[model samples]
Target chain A: MNDSQQNIKKNVLEKIRHGDVVMRPKIYFTLQVIVVAVVAVCAFIASVLVVSFAFFSLHESGELLLLGFGVRGLLTFIALFPWVTLLIAVGLVVLLEWLIRYFKFSYRQPILKVFFVAVCVVCVGGLLITFTPLHTNLSDTADRGDLPFIGQLYEDVHMPHEDKGEFRGVVVSVATSTITITHNDHDADADDGTRVVTVPTNFNTSILHIGDRVYVAGDMTNGTVTAYGLSKF
Target chain B: MSDSHPPYPTDEELVTRVQHGDQEIFGELMDRYTEKLSRYGRQFLARPEHIEDLVQDVFIKAYQNIQSVDTSRKFSSWIYRIAHNAFVNALRAQQTAPISYFDFDTFTAHPVYEDGHAERKEAEEMRVLVEKGIKKLDQKYREVVMLYYFENMDYQQIADILHVPIGTVGIRLSRAKALLKKELPVDTTHI
Candidate 1:
């Protein structure tokens, strides 16, 4: 080889030999393995919890025992847990291997394959745990009357009339696209003292009817009330 | 001179040592493969800046995942596989960005010889020209030429490293040689 060519080869070799490419330490690898194992355990626990919750909910409602089958359902689920976990674990490992091979990750960065496999195992374990027949408690529904703005909106819009010392109620009804609500209140005053208001319906205001609770803003004239805006509560 | 140790250890021995966490053995593997790997990277990627990075990545991966690799399989092939994967990934990443150029003048200016002589100047000029010529070739042709000429890889080994058919490697090498011949100075008596 020519002197320059030889020099180039030598230079290239020296550079290759001395070049620093930082890599994750062995401790990091060990930690990664530990974390993966922990994640798998946690995932398995989660799966078991899910199964148990489903089972407990069913059992407490007496649904499992009602059809003359007591403890058999629970016993069968318990018996199958191990097989299910094992299947899940095996599936996880297979999926991990397939992914690693398919992506050629091991060829690129080998440790990445190990990390991904561990993650897959954990995910599978979690799935196995969640598939168990365990119960999850449902929260109680809130009372609708306790909601804000409903009672005030109800009182302002509804009017009533009195006849011979007996009060007759004027009910106001409000309808939207999905719901309709009605409110009724009694007033001692009769026809001459009472006023009815008709508000124009725009984008914001709608017509009020019997058994409807509405909030109105405007003036009450001689036996005629003019409303500026009407809102249904 | 030939009495004691072989010039190169057997592939199996090297693999065993590497598996046992012999960092020097891993470095030996790097020394053994770097040229071929660099040429492969340069040819496939068409980028000089990424060549060393790709080579280093290949070696590191080989070291870390040596267990999964079958011991009976050719170590060179396994190393090449790692290099090839790294190069392909780097190439894909490059596609999304603009190409960058290195200062070749600065690279070639470093004197190869300490003696101040007219012959050294001529050789330096030729070296510069040759480097430029190699850089000018199409990425694929340049890689095959570099591997064949600079790294001294046979057609089959080049084919294995490149994951190409042996015939394809032969054809490419012939084409690359023809192209280099045209690019180089046509002196009847000189190399």
Candidate 2:
């Protein structure tokens, strides 16, 4: 070996022999792997739950039906979109990606590929979870005031957005050109929860029935809603 | 013509022994990797005087972190990874090139592929050009060239050491060659 090579080898071995440098215990690395794995799993679960809840909220709020109501409905859907939930989901996915990047399988692929794969997996998992009763049970818990901190998310889901010219309730009475609806079962006792909706001349009430859940888009002046768009969910 | 000595232990075997508390065996690893890492450091740091200290630091880190090495994988990759980090940190301290926080090359997919025969031929032809124009290339491109042509590492090994995608290694090498062509004296396109 050359003089320089000998010097490097001797200096390093001397450091090791003299205890200036020492190998970390096996448990240290083991714990590091375990912690990364746990955090990754936690972030993934949080991402899936947050994404699924966002979709569920949009559907239960009758906002999903707004997409079919034309431009105004589309605008309301965008305005009421759960941006916070979406941001949280994105953050969780990024955290998950950062955690998994240290692994061989993930590092072998392009970051975009890994990020795309993670997003797809989380979105699919979220959609699949929507089919389950998880959110339904959670919503019910929130309604009862038993849920901590997140109860507000489910509180106003069934309420009408008067400011946005959007209303959701159950049809209580139907006439030739008008329909009377009451706030969803949650506020049945509130005397002011009912409204009279005036439909267009060509509007069809043949598809309408009492007690059907419906969405109405119109201007509400006083206790009556001048309806321009209406649909039954 | 009988062989007098038994076959030497592989780097993986030696590392496994080191992990199992064979501290002295690290000296053997140091002896094996010092020259190789010095060459890597010299090419990467652009300062031959600093290579010995940098190589020594790499050995110290490798020895201290011996328990973290996975015996199933290549020990060369692990050591080279340490060396790469050390050299990059030194270069960063020197502010030689702007290595951004995010590398877009790794952020997206590239269409480049590694063909063994073609890569060997291209590397041979580009070696002289790379030696002449390497200092002008960016840090990100220069390191891949050093690892590929100078260290003789394959795309996957370079990816492991650099913690980048294999396709990234290919893209960087291709881009490095393009840059070298522009910076070199001859018309490299004919090669």
Candidate 3:
């Protein structure tokens, strides 16, 4: 060995002998693996729950019906979409993918491949979760005002987006020029849920029943909605 | 490399000993990797100063992290991974260029078709010409060429060391080779 190489060996050996540098214990690595695994599982579950909740929100609010109302309805749906929740889910998926990349089989593939698989897993898992009574039970708990801080998320699910010209409720009565519906504005069962909506002459009021749920799109004047588009839900 | 009839304990065997508290056996690892890391540092840093210390730091870090090594895998790959990080850190400290957090090339999949013997021969033929033009290539591309040609690491080993997809190793080497062809066209006729 050359002078510098020999000196490096000597110095490193001396440091080791003097206990200046010590190998980390096996438990340290074991704990790291456990921590990583727990965090990854938590991230995955959080991602799935958030995605399912988003779907539940769109379905319960009748905002999803806006997609059929035309371009303006589509725009309003886009504007009212729960993007913040989805963004959080996306961030979690990315974090999960990063953690998964530590594995040999996963790291051998490209990041995009692994990420695409992760997104699919989350979406499918989320869809499956929605099929369960999870969100339904949670929503029911929220309606009873028995839920905690997360109850507020479900409160808006049944509320109308009147500013965006969207209203959803059960039909209470039908008239030649107007229809009266009972909507859950603040309370689902309050008497104030009743509202008057004026429809165009060409609108087929004959298709409406007294107890049918409906979605109406129009401008709100005072407390009444002037209907431009209507669909039965 | 031929484990069928070996004259000495393999790097993995040495690692097992070190993990069992034989720290002196780590010197064997340092001996095996020192010249290799020195050559790597010289080519990677493209600078003479502090190369010895940088290599020494790699050994020190490896020694400290030895317990984390999986004895089932190639110890050479593990140590080379450390060397790669140390050299990259040194390169970064020089403020040579901005290293991006995300690289599009590694994010996507590419086809990897490796003919080990043919590629090794080709790399050997192109080594002299490539060394002359490697500095002109981008940092990402330069490192791949150095590992594949000079260090004699295969695509999988290089991928393990760099923590990129194996296909990414192929992509970078292909791109690096193309850049070399453009830079040293006269000397690369045989390659």
Candidate 4:
């Protein structure tokens, strides 16, 4: 190396060594590791808590019950606790790393590597947990109801009450909570004119509106058999 | 290799020792990396006044956070990573709250030349021109080039430091060199 290059290297080495001594303070590394670990734990706990709270809130609002009483059914399918915790821990670590990057914090080199590996291990643990039969079963139950053909029947049944006599009509006024069906036959009496029925609050009542031709099937009790299902003719 | 200084411990060994509470070893690490890191910091930030302060900040952070570092990985990369982060943060701070009194021209003035020979002057001018060319390049290209040439890091090492793919490092280096060659009167092709 040239004299200048050699000088530069020497200067760098000397400065680094000198500065290393001056800058290196005792207990800093331990403190840093503790800080990182604490931050990771806090973030994971916060995220899981927030998610659980939102889920329970939705359930209490009757949304989940209306959507289908699958919450209890799916609970049996959850992955083992150890696997879930491991996955959450891994997710939290990754999140912590991203946060560290965002804030531009530096940890000791050895500690950083260990933190990274711990995160990866947690991620693998989570993936393994998610793939377990219990987890898969829970997911399937949530997406599709547990009872073999009951879900389809629940989805297909839309008429007010199924026991009423056959009545062909087109939907007229539809309100926030009710559907008014008007029969096509002009000779139909005013008392038998437009059939107003109460629809379940949970039903996707958004799809039904005025002017939809529908075939209704139910018994005619007091001139109104509650229609069980309505088919678009 | 024949220097009077004791041989520097490998980063892993230093980390293991540090984890065991051997605080002295950390000082050795600081001594090992500070100068090269300062130069790297200098390349990202133009203000020579802030370079030492910036480098000092990086070392302090490294020393303080030493326990968190994974012992298995190369200590050098981790230290460089810290330095790079420090440099970027300093640059960001400068952008958000700029120092109005700072003058680039004042910082660029050459240290007084003791030898006034024509050959020495020309060589000095060449070195200045090279530095000027580097300063003119975009930050992305400038960073890779500085780490590769001034820091004496290979493409893979530069990639790791910059958090880019090896191919990206190669591309940036080639572009930076081409840009520098165009800007400098000196024949960088031969260099």
Best by DockQ: 2
The positional error of residue B18 in candidate 1, measured at the CA in angstroms, is: 2.2
Q: How accurate is candidate 2 locally (lDDT)?
A: 0.86
User: What is each predicted model's overall lDDT from 0 to 1?
Assistant: 0.48, 0.86, 0.85, 0.54
Q: Compared with the true structure, what per-residue lDDT tens digits does model 1 show for residues A1-233? A: 33433343454445435654233445666676677556655554554443343343333322333223234434533432335434555454544443443332232233334545555655554445435432121201102233353333222222321111111223333334212222233322233232355453442333445555443333445533344433443
Model 4: runs farther than 4 Å from truth?
Answer: A1-233, B1-8, B96-132, B186-191
Tell me the TM-score of chain B in each candidate: 0.64, 0.89, 0.91, 0.72
List per-candidate RMSD values in Å: 20.7, 2.4, 2.7, 16.1
Where does candidate 3 chain A have its weakest 10-residue lDDT segment?
A184-193
Q: Find the 10 residues in a row with the least total lDDT in model 4 chain A.
A: A155-164
Model 3 local distance difference test score: 0.85
Candidate 2 per-residue C-alpha lDDT over A48-112 given as tens digits, one digit per residue, 9 for 90 to 100: 99999888888888778878877877887788788988999999999999999989999989998
lDDT of 3 by residue, A1-233 (tens): 68898778888999999999888898988898899889999999999999999888887777888898678889888998999989999999999988877778788888989989999999999989889999989888888888899988888787777778878888999998889998854545553467799984498899899998888888888888887778787
**lDDT of candidate 1 at residue A80, scale 0 to 100:** 28
| Candidate 4 lDDT, B126-156, residue by residue in tens | 4454476878987677777676556656655
Residue B38 lDDT (model 4): 69
Ranking by DockQ: 2, 3, 4, 1
lDDT of 1 by residue, B47-161 (tens): 5585665665566666656765557756776677677678767876778764343212212212222232543355444444445577767656665666555555565566566
Question: 3 or 4: which has the higher TM-score?
Answer: 3
TM accuracy, model 1: 0.35
